[model samples]
Target: MNENRHSVIVIVIIIVGVILLSKLFMIQVVDDSFLRRAERNAVQRIIDYPYRGLISDRNSELLVYNNPVFDLMVIPQEFSIKDTAKFCDIFQIEKQKLIERYTAAKKYSWVKPSPLIKQISTTDFAKIQDYLIDYPGLFVMTRSVRAYPDSIAASALGYIAEIIPRQMERDSLHYYNQGDYIGHSGLESYYEKILRGKKGAKYKMVNVRGVDKGSFKNGTLDTASVAGLNLQSTIDMQLQQYGEKLMKGKRGSVVAIEPKTGEILSIISAPVYDPNLLAGAAYSKNYNILLSDTTKPLFIRPIQAKYPPGSIFKVVQSLIGLQWGTLTPNTTYACNKALVACHNHPSPVNLFGAIRNSCNPYYYQAFRQMINQEISSNTYTDTQIGLDKWHEAVEKFGLGHELGVDLPYENSGSVPSSSLYDRIYGKGRWKYSTIYSLSIGQGEMEVTPLQMANLAAIFANKGYYYTPHLIKAINGDPGKIPEEYTTKHDVGVAAHHFDMVQNAMAEALYGTAMRAIIKDITIAGKTGTAQNPHGEDHSVFIAFAPKEDPKIAIAVYVENAGWGGRAAASTASLMIEKYLRGHIERPALEEYVLVGDFGD
Candidate 1:
């Protein structure tokens, strides 16, 4: 009985030994959890972020630059701090804030590193970095925040901020991280790819205490970060600042373009905040405040605000009428109030006189002639045929559609078409008289300030215009500018026709827009008081300087201001004189615009 018991005990021991060996084999080689854990403890991946591109004006004036900042990161599984009070004192954060940040990091991933506190400035980081060594699982990553020295062009230059989840999910290449900063509007957003350089990576070795020893593999596997390409924008900083100063306390916008190059010289939206206000720690708070404001300080009025073209649109009508042979230089009409209300201008005026006086009835009759060409026997069909041709002619001038300006969210101002009329007043039911409101730049017509500036540019160019753009050169190379901006877009109007129209516009300055006249400077301009049933009329003006050799083309719009001559014309003339002469000879006029008071 003793021998049988010994044999049974030996068999039991063998069975237990086999099971133990098998389990040891599985733990040692079959499962990868142990290997992964070992690698995690030995190696840490580090991101080498590149410096964002610097931005400069056309004259090499630095507009945007990067300032060094640091982000505190923590690996939640290894994070621990015994002296909470000391930690709070060093980082300038509350104890509850630290706890909340740690909890969030834990929820993100226990092993992965997440930002505990972001965008600590150089001064702040210097004070707290030494104490970070006392806390395990904590290190800093270098980053940059954009700084604007002049603090101008807030809407045009734009601002950058932390990437959103939707943007991250849309990134197919996974280039951006949760903490990455990206451009959110204007030129910054438009040139995001070129401005954000390529990122580099390194494998770092760490001790059991989570102390970074050095680069892994003797830095053989490390990749160097490449600095982003700097931009040479066409913005004239001095002119931009001047325009902004002139637009203060006024609800309007001013846009200026170099007629020869289509390079944007100045773009200003009134009630602009400093670009620095949207950078770094104050972004969210300031953005929320701006968003809630009634006047919409955040609105980019130059390209985004849609306003009725007003009488300035009559210039477009003259060109279209001249092109289609519907009207002539000597075509005459009376200032008849029976057709449309007139402001007591002289009667029996020719095209030049009508443009000078801005007669309502003259354009009213001219549009009737253009829209009733009798192409079809039916009056409605004939009007549609004529209107379709007119619409086609208008679109060629870059109206009724986005001008493709190198900015985000440009408003495509509406142009009334037969299709639009069809949608509104059924297809074969409307006639020329029914839509006579379109004659004097009213009705369904609308335009942005940028478009109006380009219109001025077109008149300056005589028949064609280069697409208006902000970027004159890329990385100091003008040849690198997009071909579309350089290509001439012919508005399909006869070049010689511009001479008559240009002459008439020049005459207008002397007649109606007398406030726009400059000493020894020949300016061709037109003014419009856009009727607004809501309140006072919107003042409008479009002009190009030195009629012989045009240099700058500009458009100005002031909302609820009285006559176009008093406000818009005066403001535009000041901008013109400031740009051409390099100083304002009319300080009184400048002060007048600055005061922003248009009397009743």
Candidate 2:
């Protein structure tokens, strides 16, 4: 009986041992998900850096490039504030500020790495890295900071800034994390897709102390980033500089274009800031300064500002009158210093003479006739038909609508229709007399300097113009434009009308713009002194030189400057002389223009 009892007890002890072993196996190996989770919590993830692309001008001049900057990254889950004082000293930040930044970063994300300090110089980064061993959660990361070589085209080139909250929701695949740079305005903003190259990623292994161990899995899934395509603009650097010099201390804008191709040669808006002002670490403060300036130096006036076209608009009126057959090359009206008396000329003055004199009465009669003429026998009544035809002609010329230039935030100046008149003062009740100022390019007719320049181009091309464009080509391909831009648009005016108007414009240089005439250039131009109720008249001029094979067409405006011939006309002349002859022939006129001042 004792032997049987001993055998049974031995078997019972063996069974108990087998049950405990099975439980140990299940906890340690069979269900290992919890163990794996614990291991992942210990290891941190570090980002692999990518270099930003370079931005170059059409001439291959480096407008914007990148410099190596360091960001102090922190993983909140792994973050431990063991050496707070030493960390603050290394980063040259206050302990309180560091704590605040750390707290904010934790609120944003715990797994994702956040920047505690950004835009640190390479030297400072090296110094920090040397002492990184003293801190538990801190790590140094290399990033690209924007650098500008030539700071001339600040508003045109624009600046890159951290992506805002609004942009984050717009596109998440672009993977724009917090503090990522994005184009803010100008060409940079317009071509953001092409300028901002594709992003890349690489998984990195890091230790519990946030020190990078190696590439995760040997970087088998790493992607190499592509650099952005370069851009070549039609802007002439020399001409741009010259135009800016002329506009310095002035509030107006100047736009010059190649008449044949509609390529923008120069676009200058005064009160420009240095591009470097928005670069590096001082951007926020400088941006605030620019925003607070009353002059609005950041404003691009060439396309954004709308001013009365003044006499420059007379060219369009003359063309329309000729096309309607109501005005002839020999048509004439006298400038009698009074509206009624000026309507009747002592003797008939030819159309050329009328334009040369800028005869307001002649245009007044012609404008009235245009409104009274019929488009067809049955289409509409005389006034309605004439107004409809006039609207079509104006629209064909790209007036009363956006010119569709590549620039952002362009203003489409007001071009009042008959319906607009009806809304203002009951249709058919308001006579042409009420809107007579439109004939002189005043009243509700407003246009930007860019539009004025484009009008000059159309006239230069004899009623056909290429769409004005700033970018000539990208990567050696002609820039894409609309079909209407590429197609020829006839103004429905006879070809002879251009000749007659051209002659009158030539004579204008001898009349009001006499001082603007070059010895052998044979230029054609018109001058305008727009009425300004708040201050002195705003001087304006539009012209194209060497009339036969026109090279340059220009439009200039001088705010509060008396007489279009004195300030605006002279400026256009000097610009033409400089562009065509490469030097000013008239030293006296150059000195006069360079020294003459306009009261504010």
Candidate 3:
């Protein structure tokens, strides 16, 4: 009876064991969500940064690039400073400072990783790595910071800064996160789309202590980040460097354009800051210094600052006079102290001589004739119709409107219309004499150095020009230049008219710019000492070299520099000679520019 009872009990135990095993299999295979939750709790996600793109000059010289920088990051939620003394020794920071930094990071976002120490050197990073095992939540993140190989072209290349709150709200793609670098100005900002590239993400697995293990799915789920496309600018680094050197200690701007393609070869604004100042950890301090400087180095004087074109504008006036059939190439005007309306000249002068001498009366006569002839035109009998036609012709030459260059914050200079006169002086109440200075590129006719450079380009091309652009190519193709650039607009003058005006300009270099003459090169140039009501005259010069097939067209404006021919013309000629010949034969000219003593 005892054996039979034992056998029944064993059978019962075996049946219970079978039911338990079956339940275990169901829980393990059919219901896995709880396991996944447990696994997720053990690991955290970390971002892997990719390389950024490079910026190069026309000759493929690197302008801006990225260098690896390590940041001491900490996940506040997982972080614990148990041995504060050892942590302070490892990071080389005071215990209180470390606590303060951690507190600040937590305030920003506790769950998110924040930088405890930024832009630490490689040596510092290596030393920190030795003690990283002791700190559970602290890790080194390999990131890129902008590096400028050459200190030149700081303003043009611009700088990268932390993504701001405003930018975060405006951008929907969420391309950037807090502490991400973004282009702040100039070409860097203009081509941010191509230069920024695309961002990628990875699912990284980490332990319960927030330490990364490896890729979750062996990188199969990872999206590779593409490096930003390289930009090849039309800017010639050598020329740009030389021009910047020439402009040192001066307050002005210089712009050089290739006439055929309208490609900017060089753009220099004086009192520029070193690009290195905006790089690495000391960026904010240096930026504040630059911003507060009295010279206004951050201002892009080429595209933004407006100044009277001065005598350089006479070329355009000559074209208008010829187109209106009021002044011929042979038209002569007396340059006596009374007729010429200047204190210096005392003889009669022809059109060429008038421009050479910069006689005020000649341009005054031409201005009056243009207004009168336009008002009496048979095709446009109405005075307003004729005036509008004249204004339209001027506008076509890229005056009175934005030139649409790729640079940011370009200003459209003012070109007064008859309507403007009516607003100011009640229409017919104002006469040609009231605004005669406009004929000589003064009065309400304000232009930027970029515009003046483009005007030289127009003269070089005779009647047409491509929109002046700094960027030549992005990746491979010449990036999106505007369509309006391709459309040609008549200057309201015959092609032959350019020849006559160009001759006068050529003669002006001989008459007024004798000091700027190159031995073998025939350069056509005009000089202007624009009157500044606020202070002294501003020196300005516009020119193109080798008159026949103009290679480079340039404009130079020097604020408070006495004469256009003295400082402005000399600097422009030196730049041209250096660019064309790859060297300057005249060291004295370079020395003069470098000295920058305009005898205030």
Q: After superposition, how far is residue 217 of candidate 3 from its true place, in Å?
A: 3.1
lDDT of 2 by residue, 279-310 (tens): 76678899999999988888888888888887
Model 3 residue 506 lDDT score: 82
Tens-place lDDT per residue, model 3, 1-600, is 999999999999999999898888777888888778976675455566666668889898988889888889998878887778877888888777788889998997665678888887777777778888787778787878888877888878888888899988978987778888888888888888878877777777766555567878787777877788888888899999899889988888999999888888998888767898888877889989999999999998998989988777777877877777778888877654453346366456777777888887777677666765544434223444545656777887788888888888899998888788778887567665567677677888888999999999888888888888878777767645446545464555677878977877887887788767999998989998877887878889999988988999999999988789888998999999998899999998788888977552
Ranking by lDDT: 1, 3, 2
Stretches of model 3 off by over 4 angstroms after superposition? 1-45, 82-100, 108-111, 207-213, 336-343, 374-387, 478-492
lDDT of 3: 0.81
On TM-score, the candidate that comes out on top is 1
> In order, what lDDT does every prediction score?
0.88, 0.75, 0.81
TM-score of each: 0.92, 0.85, 0.88
Off by over 4 Å in 1: 1-41, 82-86, 207-209
- Over all chains combined, what TM-score does candidate 1 have? 0.92
> Judged by lDDT, which candidate is best?
1
